[model samples]
Every structure is written in C-alpha cells, then in structure tokens.
Target: MAEEKPLTVVTCTAPVNIAVIKYWGKRDEELILPINSSLSVTLHQDQLKTTTTAAISRDFKEDRLWLNGEEADVGHPRLQSCLREMRRLARKRRGGSAGAAAPLSLAYKVHVASVNNFPTAAGLASSAAGYACLVHTLARLYGVEGELSEVARQGSGSACRSMLGGFVQWLMGERPDGKDSIAQQVAPETHWPELRVLILVVSAEKKPVGSTAGMQTSVDTSLLLKHRAEAVVPERMAQMIQFIQQRDFEGFGQLTMKDSNQFHATCLDTFPPIFYLNDVSRRIIALAHRFNAHHGKTKVAYTFDAGPNAVVFTLADTVEEFVEVVKCSFPPESNGDQFLKGLPARPASLSKELLSAVVLEPVPGAIRYILLTKPGPGPQPLDDPNLHLLGADGLPCPRA
Candidate 1:
C-alpha cells in the first residue's frame, strides 16, 4: 500500500426520514431491531439534513468531535459505538487483520464536524441523519469498502435508511444479533417525483422522549405495543410499499394516517403513558381529516413522531391547498403569522374538559414555526477539498 496519507478529509450529508410504517417497539435495544418492519422517505437536503465532515491525521493525538462548530464530547455510548464501528471497518479496509506488508499501524486520529439544517432531537430522527453522515464521511476517509447501508446500520438502526435516497425500508431483521436488519431502497427520488412534504417545526425544543428510551418503555410496559408490532405492521408494510410503487396517493395517505395514530396510541398505552402529541398536534390531525373529508378525497395526510410537530404529506399540486388550510387553522402572532399564507389554519380541537384541566398555563408559543420539505436523497461525499476538516499535516483545521 502507498505510504499513509498525511491528511484525510471527507464531507458528507445525510437526509432525514419519516417512517410511513413506524418503527415503534424494539426487540433488541442495543441492536436497534424493531419488533416490526418500518418504511420511510428520505427528506430533502435543504429542508432537513445533517452535513458532516470527518478527517484523520497523524498530527492529532485524540479523536474529537464537533457539532455545528461547537465542541461535543465523543464519550456518549451511541456516538462512541458509531465511531468504534467506523474505526473497525476502516482498519479492515486498510489491510488484512494479520497482514505482513510493512504491518503499517492501522490507527489514525480523527476529527469530525457536523451541522443540521433543521431541529435536532425534536423527534425528527436527526441522529439518523447525523450518524449516517458520520459513517459515510468516515468510510470515505478510511476507504472502507462495503455497502453504505452496512456501515450505516452499525451507527444506528434507523440510520441505515439515511444511506439511501428516496423511499426506504429498515427491515427488522429476524436475526438475534441484528446483522440482517439493514436499510434497503424501495424507490429513488425520481421514482415518484410528485411527492411533497411539509415539516412543521412545532416547538423547536428537543423531544423529551428519545426513540431509544421511549421505545424501550413501550416494549416493557405497553401491552398494545407488542400486538401492533407483531400483527399490525406486517400488513401495513406490504401495503405501504405497494402504495408507493403504484403511486397511489389516496391509499398511501390513508395508511400514513392510520400508522401514525396507532404508533401514538401505543405510546399512550404505555405504563404511566407517554404523551408526545399535545392539543395542537391532535388539532392538526383533525384538520387533515376535515380537509380531506371536505374535499371528498385524500389530498393530504399527517404524521407525528415523539413530538408535538406534524409532518404533512401531500402531492405537489395540493401543497398550496394544504398550506391554505394551515394558515386558517392556527392562530396568528404579532409577527403577522409566520406560517405560509396559502396554508389554511383551524383551531386546535382541545376538548373543553381537557383545556379546563390545564387552562392556567398560557399558549404563548405552541410551535416555533413550520418547515416545508419534500422527499430527498441520501449521503454523498462532496468533491470540494475546501469542505475538508483536516489539513495536510493531519491536523484539524482551526475552524473545525
């Protein structure tokens, strides 16, 4: 092999995905294998994505990480696991484990920089995008030779989907060790080009319940979770894939709404229960139903993860219609309604009894704002060397 390169720099970005068939309860928390199969569409890069640069150098002594220009510890187990896995893959790719050619030390210092265009940990699965970008960039730096999904899965189970663009499925592999539970592409962005998604940034605050902890709680306490995982999702998975393949928006819309409701319902059933959706979220769902019913067709659909925000999906032609509905439903602020004008607004349907129970608290800020998005692609290594995080001496650039 050629002499060890003094510096290696890689830049990559990962797209977020919204599970059409949700990955709710997990059988193996560490392995991240869900009890059931799930499907999602990778979101547009400009709207919601994590851009990352990873590099290695001989001058650096410690492996360090920075997110959005701020120093971040690499000790977190999830982050550590991901970095460890990347290192393992990099060593294997560099040379055989027991090679004789110079026996070059397979170790090199690493530096990472990452930033997210949208909210992080706000039930947007930013980790999926973040880890995916890290894996992709690290793989480039180390010349790791393997399928992108294989590398992505080791970072985070859902992250595997971030390796591929367009519609994807994160199969909850039947294996005990989770080797088979990798993400696969169902369709490319061009496959169904007419799809449009609007991401409402309700309360930019990070989600109180992360997927790992929330899913574990549901698995341990929610009786309905198991049944839904085992019985409900299998059929929904097939139907959803079919809907996407056939471009059946109406059928697809219905399934998206049903699966989202069921996922939240399971959360509500957990011991002591988890309520990610508030009155505002519930109102959005109702408004979606009202709009579709009033139109006599399923022109729009809504889905929510473990947050108060709503991810609204509709055909490109109907996005204006949905936008109009959003503007009419939600209240305007002194800033003169930051939400789009075409979007309609309607009052949230908080039951009188429910509101009375907690009426003292003001509703000064229900949602920070809304984000409009659409289906997008997966991780890619940028060509510009200026995007690199490390310099020729294998030292992290000052900016990094």
Candidate 2:
C-alpha cells in the first residue's frame, strides 16, 4: 500500500476594511464588479479580523467548510467561485511547466474553517475580510502567487480591497470581462501614522437588508444612485485620494462625511426606501457635526455602511477628547473600563464651554462599545501550529 501523504495545513488572517468612498451597486453581479470605484482603509487585524485554516488531504472524502464554529454549506455559489478559481489557477501553473508532474495535493479535497473576532454581516464589512482570508489562505496552500485581487473580488466586491494593506482603491474598469477592475494600494499603513478609527457598535445584530440585495434594489430603482455613480463619485474619488496623499485632515474629513451622507441619501431615494440608520445612528451623526462645529473646524467625521453602526475617523490628538464626548452623549451601562476595546485611550476632560456648545440629552447604553483601531496591513500568514482552526483530522477544533 502507498504511504499516506502528510496533511498540509495553512492558517492566515485578513483585516476588515471600512469604505470611506463606499461601493454601493454592482455593475456585474456574477463577477462582483462595482458600478463605481470605491476606496477604503484597512483596519488593524489585532482588533477586527477573520482567521481561517485550510487543509488538504487525499484521505478526505469531500470539501467542507465551518464558519464561526458551525457547519456551513460548502456549495455556496460565492464560496464555490473562490474555490474553483483557485484550483483553476493552480492547475494552469502546473500545466505551464514542461515535463513537470502536477502535485498530488492538487487533486486532494480541502477542509476550511473560518472565524471572525468581530461581528459578522452587521455592515462592518465582515464578508470583505472573510472572503479575502479564504482566497489568501488558498493561495499559500496551493503555492500560487502573483495578483489575486481579481479572484477575491469574485467572492465579495470589496474583498479585493482587503487583499492589500493601508488605503486601497477598487477601480471600476470599463470592460466587459472585469479584467481591469482590481484593487490597488493608494498608500501604505505607515503613510499616515496619526490617523485613527473608532467603530461605535450601536448594535451587533445582522442587518435586515443584506448589502447584495440592497444594492440590486438601489440600482434598479434609485435614479440618484445613477447620477452619483456617473457624476458625483468620480470627482469625490479623485479629491479623497489627494487629501490622503497630502495628509489634509480637514479636506479628508469633510469629503468623507459628504460622501457617506450622499451614499445614504441614494438609499433613501430608492423607491419604497431603505433605512440603514436608526435614531441612535442619526444622533451619533449629529454629535459628530456638533463636536466639529464647537471647535470651529472638522475634528471628527462619521460614516455608516449598510447598518446602524457608525465608524468615526479622527487624528491621534483628537481621539481621546472625541471619545470622552461620545461617553458624555451616550453613557455606558456597563463599567467604563469595559466600554472601550482594542487600543488604549487615555481619559480626557471636556471643557465647560465646549460641552455647552454641543449639548445633547445623554442616552445610556445606546452604544454597545467602541473599537479603537487604525490603518493596518492586509492578509498575513500564520506559522504557529496551535493557531490552526482545524484539527489534524481536517475538522473544526472544539472551542475551549
């Protein structure tokens, strides 16, 4: 009998990306191509990320998947698209070499397990990180290299952005094949060291309307979406890039807020209407504007995706004060120490005059918690055997 080959396992993690210039509608659904180009900041993996482990073995009967400690359908179209494309690439590379035998691992079945440290499908771009990690881990396992953003894009439109570090832009190429529609890095994570991100988790519940379904509805009904895609976004994309390159906080903050507002406006303009922001979301928006006005400048900017949660962008110097202001407006029900997660934030005092300028009735427990993070690198491979989500038997390991 032939000696059984050792099981090959790979583990990796990818960071969540929150779009400043959002990708709303899709031009090509099958290819997951966007109607307009969008840019996003990749959040630090230490706070928000998806860890995936994949293993291939000839002994396995079939491909399988486990997500968040539960068995998931491996036949999901998007999941299949990613798996199929990865295997196709591996096969192509093997065939390109003359007199080279394809590795037996190519024919072996794969078992994958993925888990996210943060909330999933809450408009927090969980799918982006999830799919990006899947594609990246598969690449390492197959020993395939070169650009894989296009393949990741097929899994989730914004997943392509998560394939790279720092600020990334997904170009909406004018092509039928979507060959040019891939993500490119605008700047490295080190370019803007002082910039920070605060994710205010109002609710961790899954969104009522998923992004995919919502986008299709908007494309079919909202004329405002058409105008924004054709006119507004093109200009905003150019200006946003310039602001980031120059490190102009005022320009960046203003444009970020305006783009977010316009994106939500298009949602409202959709026939029958779709509401992603709740009372708490609106209140947070008002707080941000009022806080900036009190300083007579843009100190902080708020953006919302397809859920009620708010993502606030500010500089390092402003984070502490703004966080204090947030606590004042939305008091925590739990211990103050547990209210903040991720990066450590020093306590700050608010001046009486400043507090008076931005007054609002305090609402206790409105926000669940705040996740403080900053620009960080993209997908990374893990070398530690203990970090693997799957066991030696090619199955999800039981949680401790």
Candidate 3:
C-alpha cells in the first residue's frame, strides 16, 4: 500500500503595538520603509491580538483564508506578498520535512485561518497584527526559521515591531534595500510590569485615510514631516530608548504625547490636510493635558494613531484617577435614554456580544469603550486541536 502524503500545520499569534514614538512617512512605500525610527509597546494579547494558523496540504486546491470565521479575499497583494514570502523561506529550509520520512521541497498547498480579538477597521492597527500573525504562522508550519523582524517588515512596517513582546524599536535603516530596517527590543514585558494601557475606542468605523495613504500624503507634501524625519525623530528615538531602559514613566510619557502630536501635525500639514482626529479626539488630548498639569507632572499620557481612538498610558498607581478625570471632562450624551444607560466595562471573554452602546465618556459619544491592558508577549502557538485549520490527515478541512 502507498504511504499517505505528509501534511504541515503551523499556528502563531501577534499582539498590537501602540507607537509611543510614531512611524510616519515611508521612504519606500512598497518595501514599507520608514523615514524615521519609532518605538512601541506590545499590548496584552487577552485584550487585543490576532491568532493565525497556516497549514499546507496536497489536498487543498489553492491558497485560501478564513479571517475571524468568515471567508476573506486571499488574492489581495498584502496577503499574496506574505504568502509568497513565507513559501520562499520555507523552500530554503536546511532540513525540510512535512510529516517526516522524506526531505520534501514543497509537498502541499497552503491554507490560513485567522481571528482578531478586537474589532476590524477600527483604526487599531488590526492589519499590522493580522499580517504579522500570518507570516509567523506560515514560517513555523513549513519548518522555516528566519529573522522575524525581516519577515514582518514585508507585511507592515509597524508590524516588524509586533513580532516581539515588550518595548520594541523599528530602526530606520539607511540601506535602500531595507536589510538593516528591522525591529529590536529595548526591554521585555517583565521589565516594566507596572505600566498599564487603556485603549479608548472612539469609533469602530474605518479611518477615512489608511496608514499607507496617510504616510504617503505626509511624505509628499508635509514640510513638517520632512523636518521630523531629518531633525526631530533621531534625537527622540535615543531618549525614548533610554527612558524605556530606565523605566522612567515621566520621560516616556512626555515623549510619547509629543511624538503623537507631531505625527498628526504632519497629517494636518499634508497638501489636502487629512484629518484623522475630530472634536472628540481633541477633547481627550486636552483633558489629559489638564489632568497632568493639575498634578504638576504627567500622570497619564495619551496618544492617537491615524484614527480618533485614544491610547492612554499611566503608571498603575494613577490609572483610576486618570479614568475618573477623563469621565468627567465630556458632557452627557444628548439622547436622554441612552445617556442614562452607562457603557458596560467588562472583559470580552465574559461578554457574548460586542459593546454596542456607545457611551460618551468625556466627549459625549466620542469614545466607544475602553480596553484595559498591560505590556505583553510575542507570538505563541495554540495547543488546541480545535484551533488547527488542518485535519488529522494533514489536509485542509473544507469547513476551515
């Protein structure tokens, strides 16, 4: 009897990172090359992350994907690029084996299954987390090992940093080919256990300008972005790294807020002026400043990405105070019935439904709800067979 063909399965997870020192203005858009170095902290996976399982089986017809339990287009260049790159790396493995026995060069077709803990198109860098998870999982399934930072860079520039846990830096390598452009860790999650991050989801709607388009706009027209890349960022990168190393919350907090402001300033300075933040976002920033000023130093540091959502960072000691202060800053929602019904704050696992009632925190209806988290770890494979996309026979399941 002929032996059954081999099958391969790989699973990986990635956490979302909020840039303390932002990455804006790409030098090469195709390669996702950043004009300046940036730093970010990986958020807790239980709070926000993407887990993906990639498998290869001869039984599969073509490359396919199921994202968050729904069929998604795998032909997208972003998805195609990651799939092709992982396959290339897999082909180069020193000792390749699908199910043992033979040194298989390429034995099966690919299938990917992924899920995100947070809402998609919510301006939470879901794409960064998604792509990073896909590349890492595919690499593991094919018995291929390479520099994770390099693999992630092909997915997303900010994604390279998501490959690692704790505080990471995406070094703006000057090399044109982007070999030197990879993420390096400044500190591990354990290094700063006292820090806490609260994600205030201002809106679940997709940002009008995606990061790629926003970066391009800033690069082409914003003179402030030019100045930031050349003069401002290099100095900030060094100080930010030192701040992380020393666990200096005040120093880190100041730099984070400043960099976030500068990033959006470049957005406003764009030719047509892409506005990612609205009145609600402005109110949150102002409230943070007021609270910190009242305390005589920074108690809570707030940063906004390409969207209106606010990521508030505070030392564990000050979180409750900051949250309370922010709650009072905005007027109650105008809708009488809805205004009285406070937004629920609970873990996602405990709740079956997505938080639908939008409570106006400080800026009425500005924030959807807040996700509480802390520094977290990098990718890990899930042990549950239920999470596997491949069947016991090492073939893609039709249901997957």
Candidate 4:
C-alpha cells in the first residue's frame, strides 16, 4: 500500500464575550454586518470557552465538521461563508509570493472538531466563541494571518468581538461592502483587573427562538430596534468606552443593565412578540436591583442575552457578597461547594439589615449553577500534540 499522506493539524481555544452594548440586529444577513456598534467583555477561557481543532489532508473525502463529538453539516450557509472566505484569503496570499514554497497545500480537504466548555446556546454567546475558535484554528492550519475579525463575523456577528481580548467593540461600518465593519479592541484584558463576571445559568437548553431568526423578525417589524440602532447605540458606545477607560464600574454597570433591558424590550416590540426572559430570569433581575439598592450603589449589575440566563458584572470586592445574595435568592439543588464553579468565591453571610432590605422569597433550583470568571485574552493556539481534538486519521479522538 502507498504511504499514508501526512496531515497538518492545529488546535485553538476562544473565549465567550458578554455584550454590554448589545448588537441586536443586522443590516446585511449574508455578511453578518451588525446594525449598531456594540461593546463586550471577554470571559476568562479557563471557565468558559470553545476549543477547536482543524486538520487538512489529501486523503480526506470532503470538508467536514464535528461539533461536541457529533458530526455537523459543513454546508451550513454561515459555515460555508467562513470556509470560502478563509480559503480565498489563503489562495490570494499564496499567489502574491513569487517563488516561496507554501507551508500547506490549499487543495487538501479539512476536518474540523469543536467543543464548548459551557452550554452551547441558552444565550451564553456560544456562537461567538465557537466561530472565533473555528476561524482562529483554521488560520493557523492554513498559515493565514492578519485581521481575521471580518472572517469570524461572517460565521457569527458577535464573534468578531471575540477576536480580541478584554473590552472589544464591533464597529457598524457605513460601508455597503462591510470591509470597515470589523471588531476593535477598546482595551487589553489587563485594563480592568478588579472587574468580575458571574454567569447564572438558568437553562442550558437551546433557545426557542434562535438569535439570527429573532434578529430578522425584530428588524422586519420593530420600530424600537431601528431607533435604538440609529439613535441610541451611537451615544452609548462613546459613553461605554469612556467608562471602561476610566475604570468606572458604576457607569459601566448601569449602562450594561440599561442596554440589556432595552435589547429585550425590542424583542417584545417584535410583531408577534418574543419572550426570552422567563419567570426565573425576571426574579434574578429583581434580586439584582434590590441588592444594589441595599448597598446604596450599583454593587452588582445584570445583563441577559437572547435567552433567560443572566450575566452579572461587579467589582472583585463585591463578588463574594453578590454571590451570597444570588444563592440566598435562588437556592441551588446541588451542594454549596458544587453550586459555585471556576474561580473561587469565599463564603459570605448576609446581615439582617441587608437581608430585610432585599427581601424576596427563595426560589429553589432557579439557577442551575454559577460560573465565576473575569476578563481574559482572545483566541489562543494549543502547543501540545496531545491536546488535538482530532486523531491522526482526521477523526475526533474519544473523550477521556
């Protein structure tokens, strides 16, 4: 038998980003261009992230994808868009060089395997992390470099923001071609060391209305969405940037909550109306407001995406107390140790005055679990061969 062809493989991980200034609608569906500029904080990858591996070989039959161990369609329009763009860019780069030998042949078919550490949907910015990891891994496999936010955006609009670390903003470019509509880093991950994030997973199930579908409906029907995109977001983006730059938690937290509320309100304004927030979600919002009121300041702020899950932002000093308050409000079914995951938070006791001030009936099992994390860097490549998600034969390795 002929010698087996050599395979080139690369593995990388990308972090999820929670939008402070939300991107609710798109101006172009095909290009995944956002209607309004949005800002987001990239969550620490150690707690929440997507890990992806890409391999290319001449023996492979076709371009294929495996997500979370199961095979996924490679022909998905958005997936196809990302694949086509990366290959086109690689081909363009190869053609520009005179006599230099290319590292990998562009003719080889690719197999990609990706898995998210956290829930896939359930409004966790899973698509952003998944697509960012996909593009980042593929870029390494093909030796393509430079700005890749545009390519990632085609897979998922919020994904562009995942291309950078810490605070990021996606500029809703006026260009019809969308070349200028790319994500830019407002600050590095180290910019706000005291900032903390708590993800309260209300439900891990897939959302009833997908973000893409929901956005389209909102764009088609909601007048509020149009006004928010054109009028509100422009000013909010500027103010948000200043707050982050100055390390102003109160301004940042308040703006984050308002933006999230407005986004959901726009959803409600949709023709038939869409409801992503359930009873549990509403309770969490009330708890957050009451807790902040008891502290006589914005001690904690909450933001929800397209699903019922809540992302709470606060400073490092407030994490323990806020986490304690969350537990008291929504008692977890699991043990206290099991209830909290990721970065550790010391146990805190609520005073009688504070407890009475923020009085609310405890809702058992309302929150599935709490993941504690902070701002972290963007997509990172894995250096170890053992970490590759795919085996030597271009198939996914069995989970350990």
Candidate 3 C-alpha lDDT tens digits along 166-185 = 99999989899888999988
Off by over 4 Å in 1: 1-4, 96-105, 334-367, 389-400
Error of 2 at 292 (Å): 0.4
Give Cα-based local distance difference scores for all models.
0.77, 0.93, 0.77, 0.92
Look at candidate 1 and tell me the lDDT of residue 377: 86
Report the number of the highest-lDDT candidate: 2
Clashing pairs in 4: none
lDDT, residue 8, candidate 3? 59
Residue-wise C-alpha lDDT for candidate 2, range 144-211, written one tens digit per residue: 78899999999999999999999999999988899899999999999999999999999999999999
TM-score of 1: 0.88
> 1 or 2: which has the higher TM-score?
2
Candidate 4 achieves a global lDDT of 0.92
Candidate 4 C-alpha RMSD relative to the actual structure: 1.9
Least accurate 10 contiguous residues by lDDT in model 3:
350-359
**Candidate 1 residue lDDT tens string, 125-222:** 88889889888887766667567675566566688888889999988888897778888899998888888888766677887777778888999998
Instruction: Judging by lDDT, tell me the better candidate of 1 and 2.
Output: 2
